[model samples]
Target: MSGLWDIRLEGSLETLSPFCVIAPGAEEVTRANGGKYRRISRRTLYRDGLRDSRPVVPGSTLRGRLRRSAVEVVRILSGERMPLAQWHQNAIGGIKGSDSEAAFDVQLRITLREKNPVLALFGAGSPWMTGRAAIGDAIPEGPVETDLIGGARSDDGRRDGMLFERLDADAAEQWHAMADANAARTRYKKAMRDLNATLRAARKGGGPEEVARLEAELADLVRCEEAAGLMSTNPVSMPLLHEAMPVGVRMRHRMMLTAVTEAEAGLFLAAMNHWMRSKPALGQHESLGYGLLRGEYDLWLSPAGAGDPFSVGQAQALPLGTMTAEPIAGLSGVPERLAGFMAAFREAFRSGAFDFRLASEIG
Candidate 1:
């Protein structure tokens, strides 16, 4: 109850299907034994004064669900060495990673589910901090004590929202950097595949002379990959792009305090897929869901030999260790009073926290 607050995220829903639930039905099938979602509709405004909170959802809740889904989807889609080419050979285009019409769209849906709500919450200045981050360092010593009867003041003179502001600022910076890098990798990989396909086609001329020419061309491609530093010994290779930290992007933020589980990620993915399949018109925004997944996949990496393919099943099967709560106070250097409030919420999350049901809005 100390951490609970009335926070609403502002974002659009690509789908209008009521049957489409963003969260899975069962707790065992999900991270928190349930999924969280805000029923976004087309009517949600980009910039309007105090829209109805009836359909709104909390950004933190959505983030938790989306983060879980993205990781699981990634494991299913790109975790294995299986290629779209192999699927093509079998004419089975419905598989997750297969380069079929739905593959990119499915991935995109996950990205949208993850990013839109987050962007909306931050852009609208929600009164919630990220799992990391804190208020500024302008407060007193130790954690601020909250009286059971008479509510005590935050460490800093300002309210709890100030802490949320600071945390969002820090998270925004890191989120952008990681996203840009992943985008770059996706683009570079596409280019390499196209170049290789062209060379392979040229080699089908079937003469010694043609074979020699194709081999020379192939050699050049190898050199190019080497020069780009995309040819790594690591099985899951990535380009060695020399990216300077984007201007205005801060990198000194503290690490995540709330560790998300894999079940949560899967539920998020299911919700996103349901949303995207129901609404195909909003393309690029939908694609950002996968980008968000690409951002958080590290949180729930599946162990080797958990299954034939590394996936959410692997992560879910891993014995859940003890959940720990850290002092969320000092990370962001925000006001002490504000820092404590932010920290407490995140600490609870680290210790497997959730909000209980209040009055239902359904008529």
Candidate 2:
């Protein structure tokens, strides 16, 4: 889980100009004279069933691609038949051995709305014009049954169900710290056993002098373990004999749900904003500097709404307005909101809300 977190917005891509040239001999050449506009792509660690970020769509820069993932997650969590994509219908049909799981098809949709109307209409292809690229009107008004490709309707699909209820932020942070601490302790205990085995082997093979030497080593190991606050083996730490511990351990996993309090959601979004705007963003942005054309650059973190609940984050890049950050819930800087988010996800997965299994070490 320890890795760089990246969420970025790239805009102002030069539209490729298609041109044709003809020689006196009647030979013609058609060439493209523009560079691909820099697109928004997220880069974060992929662990468990979700991406490393709070909302989990880094590989996709287009709003349509990102919203597709959201819709899928929501559907999976809701236990409903998700709307199928062009290719998805073939794969998502309830084939027994297919990759598709009827229960895993749930999706969540992410829509970014802007307070400034000018900021809402920036498009790379059309320059100062608002292009209907990804998040056009296609972005649903709270998860409805309007056909994205065609005018399709689903009687079974629930339009807009409130996913999360706002919760305390500070409490959320405390909960995650507790869970993280427990995870670290559990790992420490297994490491101790391996080190202890070395000491035990030395004592068994050597004479009386060796026994004394091994005892000293054993004592040192215990001291180190106690210093790390893992002296006793708690039930939580008992089942730790695994070779692929890093991959199989629950600490490497994460879950995201919409059913969080506004404060809790805010903390998650704020943290993501902080992480994205930090020094790391500079490196990521520099990689796409060419497509940016010329504009003042700065990243800002803001809540979805304190006054109007309908407002969301939108990305716009043009002469009048430009790209904006995603709208996160929770304005109050209470840390507990994070704790609650982590706690809820961990509990749900650990209790088998999702079909995840740890590849425990056999030997």
Candidate 3:
């Protein structure tokens, strides 16, 4: 019971639409066409005694998607607007800086683990906790076919005098209002930047009175900006291009869960189930109908012995395909053992056995 439980999820992720996973600053701006195009993420791989680089869905992207979906599930289940103070600290991790206390407090760490299953499974950085879940890069089984998709935005019609003449007076007035709003937003951004710089300087060397004044000014500026509204206006036509993997491209994805309890596993699986049912889009251009994926996976469990933790015993296959009702409460057509785990998670959540406080509260 004290030993680790190794859970493996092997799946095929097939793209239902053109998918693009672009790393930041990875886009290529073409001068010839005055267009911006981003390629899908790629990594070097050895295949058939040859080294080649091809488009790949990064493991980090998959992990991020899963973490986001899991957090959303928790939010819906708990009915909290802001579940954790720092989602990064709870779902991902945060490093303790030199000024912070060392993560050597074993009792505190154990308490955090017992309180929050998410922190226990995903880990936190306040005490340098290690995550139990790991996802491998989704590698294409065959050649990945990619194509360029082009999109364009219509002009804002402000510069076209003829078009404005044909429009009604009210429409013309609305256009002017949009232009004014754009100018106001620009001014607000500049003022905010200047205030931020002054505040930083005050905090560093200026007197406390100056710092307080700057803070108050900053708060007032924020309120004004909110009242004025924050929306893009007077948008000009621009060409957008994306180099994406075409639909029906199948990639192999694997997720490994280490040292997870039955309840913890159930919670994680429930999140996955939610993600699958919701059909949440991944990667970029979700608004443009990109990044839709269909996942079909098989689950396996292995219990390690205390004498040799690394040694995995016979793995039991749990062939629960993508079919689940509620997050953890309505799992139907699953194994009795798996259902028990789901029941345990449901009871734990219902009884408030786990603390759902803001992550900042955790020492």
Clashes of each: 26, 42, 0
Q: To one decimal, what is the Cα RMSD in angstroms of model 2 from the true structure?
A: 27.4
**Structural similarity to truth (TM-score) of each candidate:** 0.17, 0.18, 0.70
Q: Which is better, 2 or 3, measured by lDDT?
A: 3
Model 3, 1-363: lDDT tens digits are: 134567777877777788889988774755453455766798777888998777878888877767766676777788877634456555666545564556367787777777777777777666567778888888888776678878766655755668877878788777767667767876786788789989999899999999999999999998887777754343344455679888888888888888777767777767766665674577888887887776666666666333354545532433444432332233345556566666777777888887746444755
| Model 1 misplaced stretches (Cα beyond 4 Å) | 1-173, 206-363
lDDT of 1 by residue, 262-282 (tens): 222222323344323332222
Instruction: List the global CA lDDT of all models.
Output: 0.30, 0.29, 0.70
Error of 1 at 94 (Å): 42
Give the distance in Å from residue 140's predicted Cα in candidate 1 to where it truly belongs: 67
Top candidate when judged by lDDT against the true structure: 3
Residue 163 displacement in candidate 1 (angstroms) = 13
**Candidate structures ordered by TM-score, highest first:** 3, 2, 1
Clash pairs, model 3 backbone:
none
Residue 57 local lDDT, model 2: 18
Q: Report RMSD (Å) for each prediction in the order shown.
A: 26.8, 27.4, 11.5
Deviation (Å) of 76 in candidate 1: 36
